[model samples]
Target: MRMPLLCIVSAVLCLSAASGFAQGESPPAPAPSAAEAQSAKQPVFNQEQLDQMLAPIALYPDALLAQVLMAATYPGEVAEAVTWSKANPKAQGDDAVKQVAKQPWDPSVQALVAFPQVLVVLGQDPVWVQRLGDAFLAQPDDVMGAVQRLRQQAKAAGNLQSNQYQNVTVQAAPASTASSAPASTIIIQPADPQVVYVPTYNPTTSYGTWAYPASPPVYYPPSPLYYAGTALMAGLAFGTGVAIVNSLWGDCDWGRNDIDIDVNRYNNINVNNRIGNNQNTWQHNAVHRDGVPYRDNRSRQQYGRQLDGASQRAAFRGDDAQRAQARDRARASMDKAGIERPATSNRQARDQVREAQANRPRATDRQPQARSNRDNPQARQTLQNRPNNSAGRARDNAFEGVRSPARTTALADRGRTSQTLAQRPNASRAAGHAISRPSAPMRRGGGGGRR
Candidate 1:
């Protein structure tokens, strides 16, 4: 049986109520053909498509990417989980997921409380996960721009409809023309990053009625306005979003902690036999997933590397075809960091991270505060697992007398900061500032912790 054209193509084109596709007055640019994505030798993406690909998680830092990736796998519970997280931030990792145990969401859905926006988008389109992951690796900064622009485009084309995307139109100053004084941009503030309310207008009034006896076209906030919205969105909402997601951040902070890349898990999903898990692979994933039907030289090179000797003239060396593909990818990545994706963590990304980390208190300075009496058997046990208070006479935790397990568990990331502090007798008493055990972030409070 033949599949429908819209089914095989973009979710945006279907315009069904479930898809939440907004129908605008103008005839859109022709949709890309199905084969253009499925059969191309390489993937190609324009700025617009890339922007769409990156919308969900572009505003997130590298730290939260892992959780978003994992959480996006189960979208239905995203809203409940986010709401619950706002109420209970201290619950972390395993504990965090337990709160929503009866919600009937996948266990994975519980992990996304801190990343509500990602959850909402995943709820809208979980398949977009592959693209969100790819974009984070290649262009961290552009993530925010991509999110705003797509909504703007979607609004312009009348496609912003979904649980996460809302529409709002308010009367504001109009765009400046030579005849009229320029107007200050109208920034439509987001109710939350998880919910984007686009500001649009009936084009007939704004641009004057045209002769075409057609439906009134809707004009989205302009591209410049969308770009401005990106900044406004981040300035206004990213902080709250990050605070919520911190309950999950203990495991998700990829750059801060050691990431044991499940080489096999990642490879299994890579499907296309690509070489090294680098920026090139990220691009390859983005291009191919979007169905551009394009596979560039880098992808070919990575696949070629899977051959016996790679480029070496050894007995197991790959054939001429593999060598050619690898060479092609190598050349492209040489000059500009854009398309010529490399086979490792991007240098620019790494440098930005390094600079950012430089200001943070060093692991040595930010030692963990472990109880010195830990070995004395009288150490305060974790009350975290205790049952509801005992009017009914409930017992204390069985794991009693154990020193702070959270301290030890949390220290594993910060260069064993807890152990370092534990070794020095009452270190904070002398330093005057208690090197508090990096606690599970509170759901809400005046905040402080090592980033």
Candidate 2:
């Protein structure tokens, strides 16, 4: 008995030792923390992706391109401006910026209204807009560098050049005491300061040969109707001239890899004291971002902190009350300035005007009537005796297929009576059948007898 007990105890100890060894060899991993998981999921765009995003607009004139880069950072406002542009198609150039002065959009976005075609293109791919904006906000230097690289390729290919529409200039970096000289800068400016022409180009062909096979550049062509009669020769095209004086206030500060604002032009356009008197460099306004969530952790930490609770709520909920007030204020301002509010806003007034015009007989109508009377006196005499004429009988029978108001009312009344009879609790089966069945003439002819 003692030997059997010893063997069993020895086996139990051996099994316990194996279980401890197994646990020591492999332990379950702890679940990832929230921050760690989020960081892992956050998308990070590389140099190739940045190049792809910047390719389409990289060749734009310096000022316009700078404003575009700035406006892109506010995707939400860009979307709103797009909708506004579509609704108010006639509103463009300096006047348009002034008309929308009271609008609750970023100054950068407001400046884009002068180029409605650009907004139309931007609005086409909202996903691309958001991604580009996020990329710009996350990596300003990389984005600017990508633009420079693309411009160099285009310049080398002879596609980008000084033309009637735009002036392309290359500025060599000043000689440095250091071992390496700084790189040359490519600057594109509107040939005429007062008139700016937005350039449209095929990115794939314009940039000599695209380097990135994995990520091809996105090309958004301007609407043919928008740029009608403008020839696309040598992979570049220009839309109609947009006469803008002070709407464009930002310029590309390529050396610093950022946008610089012309304080005088900025002040002239952005009334209401939005910016400081001496502030020259363009800074991203978080308030105008309108609650668009920053894609990267860095941008979120940088700009997201500036938003208040109300602004955040407005971003999600559409800010209905605030928008109404803004519209009212805008209308008042436009009225004061003698700038007509967009036809979309005054739809009711337009309808009223149309109705009045339709009701009031015009001189043209009387002229047609008199001309007809002179040409066909017999018809005029026949009209005078229309009650007795065969034509009058035909005219009376013209509406024979349409039920008159009295007839329609009688039919409706009959329907209601049948419904009332059907609803009665004590109605007999025979009465219900009479109410449900159609008259003999109305019923379709079928079997003569029941089986």
Candidate 3:
């Protein structure tokens, strides 16, 4: 029995030794308390969080932060980063900005996330954000998915997507970046966007060209002294033409005034004389230095054509048409000859001629008187008969001649005194008395002589 018991005891002790070796191979640590676990999970920070976290590692720089803020991908983060960078000026131009850009970001929730501000403030190097965006695009399943998950986690930790928080957040944030898509989103208040106005030059059709007032035409008179040469030529032509036509045709027979004086005589004399005078004048004018035809030549040719046409028309038609054509020919001829008649003067001359012609006795009345002279033989016999007494006729002529001057003088003296008396004041009373008292001396002489 003792030997069996010994074997069992020995087996038990071996088992115990093996169990002790297995249990004591590793020492057991004490379990953590709740307060200690909580303290370990949370991090402590002050207002200078960015500097305290990123400055020591040289992971962010002021310039890179400013550039990232300027990029404005996540306006809230960008604005925050700018404030942080401005406070920590020493955190500028650090080349380690690349490493910070590689960190993960959560746009949906406010939590620790990758921000490009430090990278921008450090160098304004586009390579930092580009590198980050490339990485995210390349491994979207990993980095982007992680960020989404972290966003949800942050939401659970009191970072809710609420309107109240978003309104305040957007108000605090800057304008978004010019990128195709914004990198971060926080619930933001709808603010009226700043209006950027661009000025443009617009042309109006209403205002066209500007115009100025025109000056009126000035008038000048021909001076007797200055235009002596022209005046002399004109006078000579006119006088010569008038004298030649009048002396050749007495009292204007055969239409001398109508056809010859107005047409052949005036034109031939005036134009020939004027051309002779002005032939050398055109030589000094630049307008005629090339030996062009004179201006007067063109004018005269035009007038001649008009006159010829009018004359042809008149010859084909009758008297009425002839008169009208003659008048028109005269006007056109005057224009060609550079003759200008004042409207008033021409009218007066025409009126005077019309009055004289109107006042003359009609041919119809004069014809009968002329016929009476031819027919009346008795009237001729009476006129021719009897004044044969020479002494008697001479005595009668002497008596008439003697009585004529005395009678004329007495009548003249009487008329002057009577006119003066009639014009005087109270002359009517004096006239009455003189009429009643009648020439006393003459009356007494007449009565005594008769007695």
In the range 1-451, model 1's lDDT, one tens digit per residue, is 9978777675544545434434444444697788875655333444445544544333333334444644433333444565565566444333444456566553335545434334334444433554444444333334433433333443445333222222233233333322222122112323453332333233333222322334333222322322333423211222222223123321222122222233343343232332454521122223222222213444334432333455466435554677878877777777566553434458877876777698778766644434344433444454444567764433444333255677655555576776687678587677687565765766566656555
lDDT per model, in order?
0.41, 0.83, 0.32
Residue 331 of model 3: what lDDT?
A: 85
lDDT at 376, model 1: 38
Candidate 3 structure quality by residue, lDDT tens digits, 145-203:
22222223233343323321122121211243223222333221212111111111101
Over 119-220, each residue of candidate 2 has an lDDT whose tens digit, in order, gives: 878988888998888888887777777788788889889898998888999997534312222287789998999999888888888998889987898788
Rank list by lDDT: 2, 1, 3
Q: Which stretches of candidate 1 lie over 4 Å from their true place?
A: 1-41, 44-47, 73-95, 100-109, 115-235, 238-451
RMSD of 3: 57.8
